[model samples]
Structure formats: C-alpha cells, structure tokens
Target: MPEPPRPEQPSDDKVLRGLVGAGPSQLSTHAALRARDASQPTDEDLAEAERDLVLVRRRYVPTQNLPPGIKPAN
Candidate 1:
C-alpha cells in the first residue's frame, strides 16, 4: 500500500497563539525547556523557541507571558 501524505504543521503564529492561550503551566514548561537547556537547540527548535518567547511576551504580561495582559488584537 502507498503511504499516506503527512498533515501540514500549524504556522508559527498559530502555534504561538495557542501557547499563549494555554496559560501559565504550559508557558513555564516551554520557558524551562528553552531556558534551562544550555545546550544549543537545532535551527528549527531555536527559531520556534524564539518565536514562542516573542509571542508569549506580546500576548501576555511583561513578566514572561504569565497572564493579566492583552492578547494580540487578531
């Protein structure tokens, strides 16, 4: 049998929006993975992480995308 085509991944903006909407615990884990791991992430991982951070900051509070701030105006 032929293999099925893989589904497309969500765009970075969409992913980050979901992450920001996910709230604190999720954000903490994401921050920890990106921050605690001193080892360099691959180009893709690094880019994703950077995008996550930027989106999180903008969408949430100034204090590490925690809460109590305005999300993107969409």
Candidate 2:
C-alpha cells in the first residue's frame, strides 16, 4: 500500500518557544501532538529544541560571580 502523507514540520519559532523555558502555547502543543501521532518529527527539530533549551536554561541561571557565601536575592 502507498504510504500516508507526512505531517508538516513545526516552524522554527514555535519549536524554539516550546522547547525553551517559555510554556507551550495551546497551538504548539496541539501541533506536537499531531506530529507525534504522525511520527513526523525530524532530527533537526530535536537538535534545535535541545539547543534552545540549553540557551533558555543559561539565561535564567544566576551569575556565578557572587561571593562564595552570598545567597540569591529574594
């Protein structure tokens, strides 16, 4: 039998927002569900997500230049 049509890949902006610290929007979450159902996510998608995640994590972390005994400000 002929193969089914593959689902469309997510836009770079959507993937970046979803993977990073930003919470997923309803539309992006729905798109991800569709992609998962269709098994259409590509390696580039995964790599981009990983890259964005690292960047997001670094952005939120406190700077390391504080004095040894200094605690984070409330």
Candidate 3:
C-alpha cells in the first residue's frame, strides 16, 4: 500500500525569522510573562489555588447551562 502524503513544512529561514523578528513591545511582553512564570509560587498560594480548583470541579453545571452552539461531550 502507498503511504499517506505529508504536509509541507516551513523552511528553517522562515521559522528562524518568525521567532527572531518580533517587535520590541512583543518581545518585552513575552519576557515579562516568562519572568512571571519562572517565579515559584508560595506554598500558601498553591494550597489556596488547589482548594479553589476543587471547589470549581465540585460545582455541577448542567449541559443546559452551557452557552448556545456548545455541545456536551459524548
């Protein structure tokens, strides 16, 4: 049997430019987000976030509560 066709990939130069060609403002925003993510969260903050997530998961929202055009999973 014949193999399926593969999608065309971007050239290395194109990929390189895409990563390196961001404007100063975009680069600064990216750097700030990276710095924030690199910082470790405190134990108290982690605990509170975990508690909040548990509460959110425990609260049942019926399918009817979902916005229009959004279907529930099978």
> Please, what is the whole-model Cα lDDT of each candidate in the order they appear?
0.62, 0.64, 0.63
Q: After aligning candidate 1 to the native by TM-score, how far in Å is the CA of 72 from where it should be?
A: 28
TM-score of each: 0.27, 0.24, 0.25
Per-residue C-alpha lDDT of model 2 across residues 42-69, encoded as one tens digit per residue = 8998998876553324335466654465
Candidate ranking under lDDT, highest first, comes to 2, 3, 1
List the pairs of residues colliding in candidate 3: none
Q: What are the per-residue Cα lDDT tens digits for candidate 1 across 1-74?
A: 99999999978787667556665544567675775475666899978887666453334435344345645543
Worst 10 residues of 1 by lDDT: 56-65
lDDT of 1: 0.62
**Model 3 agreement with the true structure over 1-74: per-residue lDDT tens digits:** 99998988978776446547775433357865675687779899899897664333344566546656644444
C-alpha lDDT of residue 49 in model 3: 90
Measured with C-alpha atoms, the lDDT of residue 44 in candidate 3 is 90
Off by over 4 Å in 2: 1-40, 54-74
